[model samples]
Target: MHVCLFDIDGTLLNTGGAGALAMERAVGELTDGSDRPLDIPYAGRTDRAIVADIFRHYELDFGDAALRNFLGRYVEHLDEMLGQSPGLVLPGVERLLAHLHQREDVILGLLTGNFIEGARLKLRHYHLDAYFDFALGGFGDTHADRDEVARVAFNTLKAHRHPEQIDLRRLWVIGDTPADVKCGRAIGAKVVAVATGVYSSDQLAEHAPDYLAEDFEAVDELLELWPAIG
Candidate 1:
């Protein structure tokens, strides 16, 4: 089978800042709206890393119990923020996913920085959750690094396809960030970087992904290039 791992956020869909906004609100609740200063970068970083930084910034405890509480609050606010903001699936994503979903040779899954539940929340809100096999996906909850998350996801895909040797040549990682490119290389998966997120095409090209597109509009090209996907 051709294993296809996808990133959420700026890759699958844009939450219109709902994710960041909810996170800000949740952290505010945790800190009681304390004086904000540090600007922790979010792009391509795992949720654990992000939260760890948040805790450090506000001098909050960075333990498991504390992290869990913060994430719980973050999730609750995420649901609320999703509704309050206008989120959208990127161009041609629906058609590409629909095409891949119908193919028996392809297995669709997520490899994202969002917590698995958080990933589901975003996907479910957009009605795209049903298309993915969550068991085959890796979550940010496991590690602070995206490459580590990619390794976990790689193993999950392997276990799910037990006895079937996965062809690394046929593996794929699709996302919109340089981190995605780096992580894809971690597992030796062919990377497809799209310019659907904050980064422009030129910026993404610097990462030199195997495939780069302005958006997911080139389904035909994907099929032609990745014949195993056929």
Candidate 2:
């Protein structure tokens, strides 16, 4: 079996600045202050981690209730921001997802830094949600570290226990950041670094992913490893 774990923000689709905007609004509301300049780096990081940092930046309470409220408000505004700015899918994403969805041997799951609801909202907005197996994925709702998120995904995959041995060796982590590459290594999976996000092809090359793409345009390397099957 072939398992593909994908990152959301800059991998499958872009939400323009909707995610960041929603976060700003959430933090502002949490602190009862007007939204200030959001200067945090979010690429390749988990939502909880980012929020924890935001809480620290603003000197807000880091309690459970505060986190829940902040995230709850963030989700509400994320829905609104997405409607206002529905970012386009990156190059070749639709075609690639369609082709992969056709293969019964292929299983798709999200390994995104987005919270589960946030990931679903973005995917659904771009009509990409149908292509993923939500049950088998990991979200950033709880885990702050991306590596922890990936480890959780690895555990979920192990639960399948196919009688014929579910070849975990065939697992692939596809993303656009070095963090993605490192997390893939954390679980001993092959990495496919895409330059469709902030990282350029050369920058991603330094990480030495098993495969690299300017976008999803060159998935031939991946296809060679897991061709469509009967």
Candidate 3:
């Protein structure tokens, strides 16, 4: 079987502005100084890493209690923000997912930086959750490093299927950031870079991904280059 793992933010959905605003608000709620800017550099990072940065910026000690409180507020407001301002799935994503899902040899899963619950919330909000099997995902809760998350995802897939034979070489990782490409490389999965986020096609091209596309719009060409089915 062929396993296809996808990144959530900036790849499948457009939550850039909402995510930034939510982080800013979360920081403001925790910190005394309103003047302190919430520098939310979200690209190519895990939620824990971002939260850690926010805590450091506010000079707050990183502890479970503080982290939990911040996450609680962030998630509460995140759902509200998403409800008020719905995000869009990238072009051709729906069609691409449909095509891949029809194939018997393919398995769809997520390898994202979002915490598992956070990931579910985004997918559920976008109504994209049904396309994925959550049992096969790797999330920020498992590890802060993106590569490690990819490794975890692979293991999850293996456990779910319990395949009599397994071939890691047949795995694929799809995303829109340099970190995604790096994670794919780390785990030796075929990488497909989509220029739908911060990096342009030229920038992603420098990384020499096995496949690169402007967006999911070129679904036919993308699949032709690296078909999801094994």
Candidate 4:
């Protein structure tokens, strides 16, 4: 089977500033109004790493309990923020997903930096969650490094499916950042980088992804990458 692992934020959908706003509030709550700043870089970073950075920045406890508390609060705030300001599924995303979903040979999954719950929130809001197989991919809570997240996804796929059913050569990691390219390369998987996120096509092209597009609006080329099933 062909495996396609996708990223959430900036890739499948743009959450407006809802994610940033939720993170700011979560950090503020965790830090007890100690002037927690939202200046930390978030793109392509795992939620665990982001929260850890917030803890270090505020000189707060980074223990398991504290981290759990922070994540719980973050999820709660994320729900509220998403409800208040729902995000948008990027152009051609639904079309691409529908096209791929119609192919029985393709297995769709997620490879994102957002916590699994947060990712679900975004997807559910856009009604895109049903398109993915969560059992086959990785989440932000699984690893702090994006490359390691790729590993986690492969491992998950292996654990759930027979070894022969999965071919690394047939794997594709699709996202909108250089980190996604790095992650795909880590597993020797093909990368399809879209410029729907903060990075432009040129910026992503510098990373040498297998394919780079301005957006998914024209996915004919991308569709051609996959072979037709008999």
TM-score attained by model 3: 0.92
Could you give the C-alpha RMSD of every candidate to the true structure, in order shown?
1.3, 1.7, 2.0, 1.2
Cα lDDT computed for each candidate against the true fold: 0.89, 0.86, 0.83, 0.87
Q: lDDT tens digits, residues 86-124, model 1?
A: 889999899889988988888888989998889989999
Tens-place lDDT per residue, model 2, 1-230, is: 78888998888888889999899888887778756566788999999999999998887778788888887999999999999985889988888888888888898888888989998899999999999878787889889999999998888777754625446577899999999999999988899899888999999999999988888866565578677655
The regions of model 1 sitting more than 4 angstroms off are 228-230
Residues 36-136 of candidate 4 have per-residue lDDT tens digits of 44578998899888878878888887877887787798888888898788568898999999999989999899988888888888889889988987788
Candidate 1, poorest ten consecutive residues by summed lDDT: 221-230
lDDT of 1: 0.89
lDDT of residue 124 for candidate 1: 97
Where's the lowest-lDDT run of ten residues in candidate 3?
221-230
Query: Which prediction has more favorable lDDT, 2 or 3?
Result: 2
Instruction: Extract clashing residue pairs from model 2.
Output: none
lDDT of 4 at 203: 92
Error in Å for residue 129 of model 4:
0.5
Worst 10 residues of 4 by lDDT: 30-39
Q: Give the winner by lDDT.
A: 1
| Number of clashes recorded per candidate | 0, 0, 0, 0
Question: The CA-based lDDT of model 2 is what?
Answer: 0.86
